[model samples]
Target chain A: MANQPISEPAQKFGERVRARRHELGLSQEQLADKAGLHWTFVGQVERGRRNISLHNLLKLATGLEIDPAELVRGLRRPTG
Target chain B: MANQPISEPAQKFGERVRARRHELGLSQEQLADKAGLHWTFVGQVERGRRNISLHNLLKLATGLEIDPAELVRGLRRPTG
Candidate 1:
């Protein structure tokens, strides 16, 4: 599971996190501290290399000062 | 990490998923099949016993036939 390829949803989620971090003028280290996560993990998440858990997802949203829902606002399920 | 006690967000998320699944008239087995997860895993998720990954979260939303954001629509970051 750790080595699974990144999915489109993961990529988009990473982009949203990166954009939000930029909007807040925070560095990856700063966001990591605020989110109670490691800087390396934050970097991984921003690069879409981690399939983030719900707990960390909420922490990231808190660190970003946004509603948790906002992080996933525009994502849609892929159609078959 | 695997043994962490269930948090409020996880509990709430589970409740939302259960409600939606019931609304859709789907059993845990049915929902699991739709979401491409194991039935036991789906049961754990509905019971808030798993710290679900973002990938599976999206899958669950798709199985529930709702927008991914809808699963998190009213969730807010807890204030410190």
Candidate 2:
């Protein structure tokens, strides 16, 4: 068995979040405010530097006014 | 803004994880072993008692041989 980090999916997820936030015309600070999170934390999430928790995932989805599933759409299993 | 915990989605995700694990004929311990997680942690996830982190979510998805997006499918915004 090979062990590979799932960084690609995390990066892709971050990109989706960034794109959606842009589509909503929101600055990271504004999105963070809407999500009841700190701007730095949101930035870290956008950069895929941290693993987001489910609670925060819901917060992001609500802040973006999208389905939670939408954020993770099209993320296939990354090959190791 | 009304703040409601996203317990429903977490529960739904947990149910999906549990179902997938069962479909693969995996006990909690077995799944946990495959995912490199503790059995107690897997149990908590299956019970939706804790918010799952993205890293662990990926691990669970990989252990179940499914795409990560499938874990979050059909999770709508929980009403406040």
On DockQ, the candidate that comes out on top is: 1
Per-model TM against the reference: 0.87, 0.80
Return the clash pairs for model 1, or none: none
- Compared with the true structure, what per-residue lDDT tens digits does model 1 show for residues B1-80? 65442776777788899999999999999999998889999888877788888888988988898877777766654444
Best by lDDT: 1
Residue pairs in clash, model 2: none
The local lDDT score (0 to 100) that residue A45 gets in candidate 1 is 87
Compared with the true structure, what per-residue lDDT tens digits does model 2 show for residues A4-79? 3237777777888899999999999999999888999888778876678887887888888887778776564344
lDDT of 1 by residue, A1-80 (tens): 66442877777888899999999999999999998889999988888888888888888988999877888766654344
Best model per TM-score: 1
The list of candidate 1 runs beyond 4 A from truth reads A1-5, A76-80, B1-5, B74-80
Per-residue C-alpha lDDT of model 2 across residues B1-80, encoded as one tens digit per residue: 12332388877888899999999999999999988889998888887776888778878887888877788865654456
**Lowest-lDDT window of 10 residues in candidate 1 chain B?**
B71-80
**Distance from true location, Cα of B40 in model 1, Å:** 0.9
